[model samples]
Target: MVLRLFVPPGEGQHYIVPKRPDPLGANATLQYVVLSSTALAAGYASFAARHERRIAPPTKVSRTALFIKASGRLGVWAIVVGAAANAYYHRGFTTVVVSQLVQDPTPPKLYEKTDKYTVEDGGLAGAAAGFIAFLPTLLMRRATVPWWTRMVGMTNIGAGTGVIAAHAYFQYTGERQKAMEELERQRSRRMLEFHYIFWDKLLMQRLDPLLQAYVRHNGIFRAYHVPAEVLDAPDKYGILSMPATEPSTTTNAAAPEHAPYYIAAPDWTEHLKALNTDFTQSEIENSEREKEALLKEAEYMAYQLSLKQHAFVHSTHTNDDDRQRCIRELQIMGIAYNRLRASADEADRRIFAGRQWLRQRAAMDANAPKASWLAEHPFIPDPEAHDPSMSIAEIRKCEDQFKIEIQVFESRVRSEVREDVEMRERWRRDLDEARTLLRATDGILWELEKKCPPKRDVGEVEVRASAVEETPKVEEPPKSLNPEKP
Candidate 1:
């Protein structure tokens, strides 16, 4: 009863007529309907599943409907072509057999001709019955199927196509499956990569400076908050997703909390929107810490450069007072630079920690006062508070604190330097003692060589004195002197 039609590229189409019969012919038609419908439904399911996974979400058409419709259309075309071919064959052969029977008029041949006609009529009737086959395919197109089922349907269609093709079915099927899987995997990888890069370039980098600045201004001893607008603007102001892909807004509204004075890049504004909402306290703290560390490194480098420049100038110039003044200024500048770097680092650490604390606090109490605390502790100052008047006493007190802090820091640095110098001096003294001992050893060796000369092949040691020996001649000289006196 099941009639399966497969179309070939050039040979028209082939039909598989099932060997089931019904006295009323209704059963045969119904079975054909069921089989064809199942095949078409399976094919559509497979196509939809593959499409959804590989491509972007469709805006208008649902994937399932599209697949079902396409599959049904294809199935109908195959059946129509197969049925038409069967009908032509039946009609032409029947006419030829009847014409032969009329000319011959043999009893036995007539009987054979009648029998052949009956078979041809039966084929025609079956093709007519095949009309019912298209109904199931039509209905399935409107119904929804699970995703996995859709994939299975696609696999079945692919396998069925391979079987009917008569050449390299398994190879083609394997290759297609592999290619599709690889393509899906690649797409997933790309999505993940884009997510990470987008976060780095847009959100994290933009917010980093603001966080650091906040920490630099506020100490770890006190609780502080970064502004909500600073956080929310990035989320809402999506430059990357804008219509016509125009650059992100660069107006003051897009600027981060503390670093309003600094201009943000259009790209950064876009990135800010793409950042994940679930930012952790540790992450913020780490970011601030890194920023402060970099700032300190820069300050240290600058101080070193200044010191070198001052020394170079002093060496070239002949003025002693100018050199002394330059040296003093260098020392003061070095101290100030260090203090600034330390203060900036400390502030950053505190702010980052405070932000973390605030997040935790908010989690504990839905109506927490953390937001207000953040507004008061903005990374940047309000325009009105930019230049505030201060009393003399307050200014003096501030100066005194700065002085005390600087003095303490300088003293520590000096102590470290002194210790290093002392260590070097000790090493130098040890080296000097070693050198002296070596010299003394060399001198003693030289004297030993003189006192006990090496014995050579010449003979016993002979003393060749520089002074003349006058022992025997002294008596003769004295006698002559006495005779002369007498």
Candidate 2:
């Protein structure tokens, strides 16, 4: 059995009826059936409310809606064109039938004289044909039609149908293209956001200490000759491995041996893998040779700069007439110092590049040598493989050169100090004479104060009284004695 019911909008109601049936044979089926109906109704009502909540309201017309609307317009034009074509064909057929009727010579029967099909029938047939021809257009108009229907309709139509289809297709294609572009933009934006967050919060903050420790253990700070201030700058180094509360100074303390020579992100290995090419042992050997040549050139330039500075300092003290010439010599020395510093920097860069190339090459090798060729060379060694102290003999030569430069600098400094001291002593004597003149001026002021002292007027006062006081002293007689005498 089937039942249909309509529930009015915004109103809800339920009906329940209770009836008892015999437990035995006769009404047993009806009893169970009534309970089932009640349960089913209750389930339906509960599910309806949940389903309603799950469905979101439409805010804008979807792509499907726009496509259907566009297809409907295209379908209208198809029907009109098909109808016109059908009408023309029907008119031609009617003309042929009339010509045949006109050629008949016998007396015309009314029914026979009439055309088998009327104009109205022809119009109806044309309309039917036009509607049938517009089947694709109708399919496209349906909201549930698949995406491929639009694609086919747009591709196959000609003239009237073709123009309409092309318009719809262009709009659809444009929207799809726009959507893809927007997706790409969103993806790029997300990647950049992740990059910035990782650099600032994860890599810079969390991993910077490890990097600093690695740099220090590898003697990078000493090799680069970085000043304490530059290494400490947050803008330059990102973070210090040491705690802020601890003293912000690093003395000649030994770096921890277990510290890494390079601290890199987990992905750095993968990044190098993508680079494809790897340096070979021969490449590393060539790099080392280049580095040695650069270093030698730098050392020679440094010696020349030092010699020029010495000559300038010595010439300055020779005579007053040569003072202009000495100043010119100092300028030349300044230029040499700059050139030597540049050469040293270039040497340092070459050495660093060679080391890095060797490291990468070693990583790529399946069975790398125990030590690089640099370490085996007679002039240089792998600092890691052999004790760096073993190279002290080579380092001693550098030390001797350093000591000679230091002695020359010290002698120049001492001479400058002696000249400064003598000039200061002469200035002191001149100052003493000026002070003596001031003292004499003070004495003259004192003598003048003693000879003519300032005075103040004091010690005298004058008073004046009137002479009428004596006349006022004349007295009146006592009243008690005067009564008896009168």
Candidate 3:
């Protein structure tokens, strides 16, 4: 037979019965389990992203970083879980426990004076329990991660917590179907924020040391994940497909043979700088070429266009096919010039952006600015700048807001850039077509000059005839003078 131990205020006694479950305590335990599971999931995502084999080899993670990461996860979990557990236990499980007390079969004699709970005793016991509970509160006293990681994590956790709370609320209110539908509909947004922070936590742990090493090895911190090709070809928008380079025999004589890959940092930075320079140089060359192209087009127009030629075409007899062809070439030229102007304007804008980017990188100042933040994060916002006094919870809210903003901005920028590139390409094609048409129009005009000469006025022809007939009346008998021959 199973026996249960019962502790009265005065004595501990043994009784034969099944162990009574404290429903409130059980509910609290369950809530803890849920919290732990969520925390563990986040941890696992962090770990996998940091250590994934396909991406990069394992880099040394600083103990400080790991501790800070774990501590944030643990502390956040504890507070949120504690509050949820308390709410669940007090609101629902406590009533069930009190109702279940009536099912206890012990006699009145079993309930000694110690078994009764009085106000003073309950208060004393509660004070002890509260004192014990206060220990977990100390964990949140100091943050373990860097400010940025804390900013990102807190934001992620808050969003995740809201999602969980919303789910729970839906379940409580018997709107499970609606909740499921919403979850499915907004799955990408939810998943993106969740995973971004999840991976970001891991990256913060890995990147801090890497970035520090970059600074130590090289003079500056080049943000990781700024596509290798972006640095490789800063002048261009996309990466060039290239073969891998062979190892070089050149070496820095002053450097240690076994020095870790700090060279990669400067090499990349220099490449980007070179690309920026190249882009500037290319822009100058392109501007010159654009001027030449426009001049050539203007010359072609000067040679082909004139009131005399236009009047000749309308006055002189011309075939329908030739007339239609001439009109088509004129239409093509007009469209080409209009598009070329647009393309030229767009190219100037792109060139300006390139120059601005170069200037920004060259003159990078304090880390407080948004440019500096984007260099580090590429897309995340500056929480400290937004609200220096924000708590972890508030930082999290800020993070969510920033995340959404960044995504939308990125999408908009990408679409606009794509359209711009396409427009530029289309303008080039149109310019080429116009050039071809101009050549074809020249050939057609040459054929027209041969086939149909311009009409002359009768008065002008008579004057020309009189000037030629200085001898006068040599027409006496062109054929009669040689009548014998006729």
Give me the runs in candidate 2 sitting further than 4 Å from their true place: 1-236, 239-325, 328-361, 371-486
Question: Of the pair 1 and 3, which is ahead by lDDT?
Answer: 3
Tens-digit lDDT string for candidate 1 (337-394):
6776776666565565546445544543465564443434465465333322222223
Worst 10 residues of 3 by lDDT: 10-19
Ranking by lDDT: 3, 1, 2
Write the number of the candidate with greater TM-score, choosing between 1 and 3.
1
Better of 1 and 2 by lDDT: 1
How well is each residue in 1-486 modelled by candidate 3, as lDDT tens digits? 111112211110111111112111112232343345447646755775666564334554444345335545665666577656555433342222222322322321212232222222322333344345434434655543455444434433443353355445545664454434333323322222222322344433433453334323322222233444444453243222111122232222444433321112135344444443322443444444454555566556545545435754676446888777777776766666666666566555554545554555555433235544232433437533332221323333433443454454344434646556544543444334334444544554344334322342212322344444764656442322222234
Per-model tally of clashing residue pairs:
8, 1, 2
Q: What C-alpha root-mean-square deviation, in Å, does candidate 1 show against the real structure?
A: 37.6
TM-score of each: 0.20, 0.20, 0.19
lDDT of 2 by residue, 1-486 (tens): 011111111110000001111111111122122223323333443554456444323333344333333444444444455446434432332222223322321221112112122222222233344345546555555444444443322222222232233334534655334333433433322233223323343323433454334324433433344444443342233222111121121111333433321222235455434321211222233345444555566577668767866776665465776777767766776676577567556545545554554565456564555544233356534433433322333333343443454454344435646555544543344334334433544555344334332341110000001222334564752232212233
- In candidate 1, the residue pairs with backbone N, CA or C atoms under 3 Å apart (3 or more residues apart, or in different chains) clash, namely 45-150, 46-154, 202-271, 215-347, 215-348, 225-374, 258-379, 258-380
* Residue 44 alpha-carbon offset, candidate 3, angstroms: 63
Which parts of model 3 have CA positions greater than 4 angstroms off?
1-275, 278-280, 295-314, 365-486
Model 1 regions lying over 4 Å from their true place? 1-283, 295-299, 302-314, 318-343, 346-356, 359-486
